[model samples]
Target: MKMSKVFRLLFIGMVALSVLLAGCSKSNQATSGDKKPNELVVGQDANPTTMDPHDTQDTLAYGIQKTMYEGLLGFDKDMQVIPVLAEAMPELAKDAKSLTFKLKKGIKFQDGTDFNADAVKANIDRLKDPANKLKRASLYAAIDHVEIVDPYTVKIVLNKPFAPIVQAFAHPAGLMISPKAIKEYGKDLNRHPVGTGPFQFVEWKDGQYVVVKKFDGYWDKANAAKVEKITFKPVPETASRIAMLKTGEAQFIYPLPPEQTESVKGDSNVVVDKAQSTIIRYVVFNVNQKPFDDKRVRQALNYAVDKDALNKVVYRGFASAPESAIAPKVWGFQKQQMYAYDVEKAKKLLAEAGLPNGFEITLWTPNDTIRAKIAEFVQQQWQIIGVKATIQQMEFVTLTNQLSLKPEESKLQAAVSGWSPSTGEADWGIRPLLSKNMFPTAGFNSGFYVNDQLDKYVVTGLESGDEKERLNAYAEAQKVIVEDAPWVFLTVPDNLVGKRKNLSGVYVLPDATQDVVHAEFK
Candidate 1:
């Protein structure tokens, strides 16, 4: 053969190999597609601190744990309390001190133990037990005793009329765990959570991922898990989380930062879901600390920071400044006159509090992108008033633990934080944050604020079953708390979730937790 003919033959052979490889690639693609999983992967802001339903105060943890646990009560999309394990709403006595619930029958825990009146009693007993020292124990303090009327019937006797009891029961703190698991694991139950939710705990790889699988014996088949498995992966970086969603690495990601919403919306493969949130973002002060101990200084900080600017810059106007101690979406929210933005007025208040020169303070925030931005904005705003704010960012878990320290031991001066009244009620909005008894060791009142009048009003709100009376009481409490300025009230942000367009049935609730019970891949 001539040299030209040999060159032509070599070219033909190369082209043939390319065609063969292309066909093999197509075959591999089809084979991989056929084995695609019916699983949901969620990218969240942070790792859950615990799996124990009764022990955690961490919002992220509770949200994930919700998939594996359920309470006798559950909340609808509107945050209204509804019966879940219970057959119907409880029957209240004339005095409102006693209530009875009829449990649903044929429900079994993930551990195969029966879910009955006995399970309810076991949970209540654990929460009320002084030795257990659960983080949410104070929420159930009004419960005097639990009486089993039958296998499926139970009566709760409260020491007094606790108006928010039913609503509180709808909270994750009320989520029931297997009594058998509770007894076996005891202190270590955080590692081995077992419940009767639509999903059962598969495993938790700390700082990595947590997984749950469909519970085959899940009682409510109509609302059963639509996916074989759900994996919660903590991707604290905002950009990384969005990239995961866009690339199909995750089915859902929350909360989609407000600034990034428009960008994510433009992606055809992703959908943004918004829910009006009960989350109240604020900068809480440590009243036990020097300058902050002065209400005028606290008020000055609130006056100094322009809430409208903060919302515009940090939340891109997707958030609104809180008009009450609680978000307006929560039940019994009463609007109040909040501190107006005035740098001069802020300086005046500081001078009146004997700090005319302005003092130096530390503001701690979680190492979150948004929160760090909040701290930075607050720092710049306070600078105009001669206030030198040194911003410190730490891991969320560390920041939370630092704040939980007893007032005398805690070194927290000011911290940027947020709370969602996950219970969707006024008492939860006020009691855990402002009531005197809630200080440090007892509840989330890390500020160590004390006001006898405010305390009385919260108690009144909690003890009264009358709607009018409770409303009036909460109104008064909000007035006192707003005036005292324990916190530089920030914004009530909308819960933003980014999901794959093909996904449905999962959403971020008004309380800002993910409800994944019905999540499915289309």
Candidate 2:
């Protein structure tokens, strides 16, 4: 009886050992096959409206496009232009009216088509084509035509000498798309974009997330993506986005509200990064509208704005008071205090404009938390000057459309808007906001403020080959615009970004776009 009992015990032990070995083998296979930890997830406030690079001007779309598209040139973290798909910087002709670029050979789009000079020409042609009506069509107005010198070389002939054209190529207007894909998909190309970027689009679940995976066959594989996959999820609510970052549900979040920066710093798993940005937040006057047409009234409004108070209250002292329409980061920004906050001065200007009793006006602002606060503050301050201001809120996209309408068809008296010149040049900062050429349908000029003297200086600045001469022209333009008070120059907010402590390689460009090409979790 003792021998039989010992045999039973030995059999049971052997069975238990086999079960343990099988469980270990299964776990190893599953880990190797599927649940890898090389994926990164990011949360942002908005979803991209379209994938077609040329069809949209939304910053969110540009952020997503950067992952999949490669322009002829790109900007470094310091806002300097660098060649991306081009073998080198373009060779400028002596007159600066033409540019020749040599394309990098052996590069192919995600759709497996060769990227050649023809592809570049096709993109420019599409952008300049009036039928397409791209929101950024005016950006390429200087380009007269494109000529292909060879399979790898192309020449761009300009109608005028445009000094900022090269930098403009680094903007979204310069992003290249697969011509083959465009032809096949037509207007539906936005749904299935193909590019020669480091990441290839996998799927986009509307209002939820966009998924992209590393393209192993990318041309520059050495500096290619470190993470295997990236999932960009749209968490519009600020609290929810912050919660995701804290819980590791999202590895990165951008435009981190300044009020929450301190709270985020207390979290052990998150880090906050701040950088000087070229973004300018200001209130645009509808120059075509009533009392605003009078320079005295506009100047009165500028003097009435308490920018210092706004920075401290709305931005939590994280923003700098703007001295000019162009942010200080732009090349030719000149420091000017044309209209300092002085309630007495504002009242005097209003009386000088024949309105001792301030009139009623409506101020439009987007339905954003910080902007809402700014609008309310402006209303309270204007009341001190005897002006009755009513605040209206709308979705950002709707607000943009409302600003785009013709003055006669629109009811925009004043609107709070922001501008970030994508090219990091003073010309872009000034021309789109003050030039008559940009009025009516041009996407950037919401104010329709026109001054012939400003236009002359802007044109001269664009055509000048000498750097010093260009700077002088832009400086003069800035001085005139500040005096004109087309906009109530407000603040230059720093680009605040939040990320998990374990994340690395995330970069914020000067224009406030996130560079995720090399982003990864440590």
**Each prediction's TM-score against the native?**
0.94, 0.90
- lDDT values of the candidates? 0.88, 0.85
lDDT of 1 by residue, 1-522 (tens): 456988999999999999999999877744432234599889998878789877777778887888889999988877888998999999989898989999999999999999999999999999999798777999899999999999999999999888888887888899998999998998999999899999998999977899999999998989898899999998877888887887777888888988899999998768898877899999999988798888899999999999999999999988898899999898999999999899999999999999998999999998878899999999999999989999999878788889888877989899999888888888888888877888766788999889999988888888876789989999999999999999999889888899887888888888788888788766
Task: List candidate 2 stretches off by more than 4 Å.
Answer: 1-36, 203-207
In terms of lDDT, the poorest run of 10 residues in model 1 is 28-37
- Name the lDDT value of residue 322 in candidate 2: 92
RMSD of 2: 6.7
Q: Which stretches of candidate 1 lie over 4 Å from their true place?
A: 1-36
Error of 1 at 99 (Å): 0.6
Q: Which ten residues in a row have the lowest lDDT in candidate 2?
A: 28-37
Q: How much is 419 displaced in model 2, in angstroms?
A: 0.9
Best by lDDT: 1
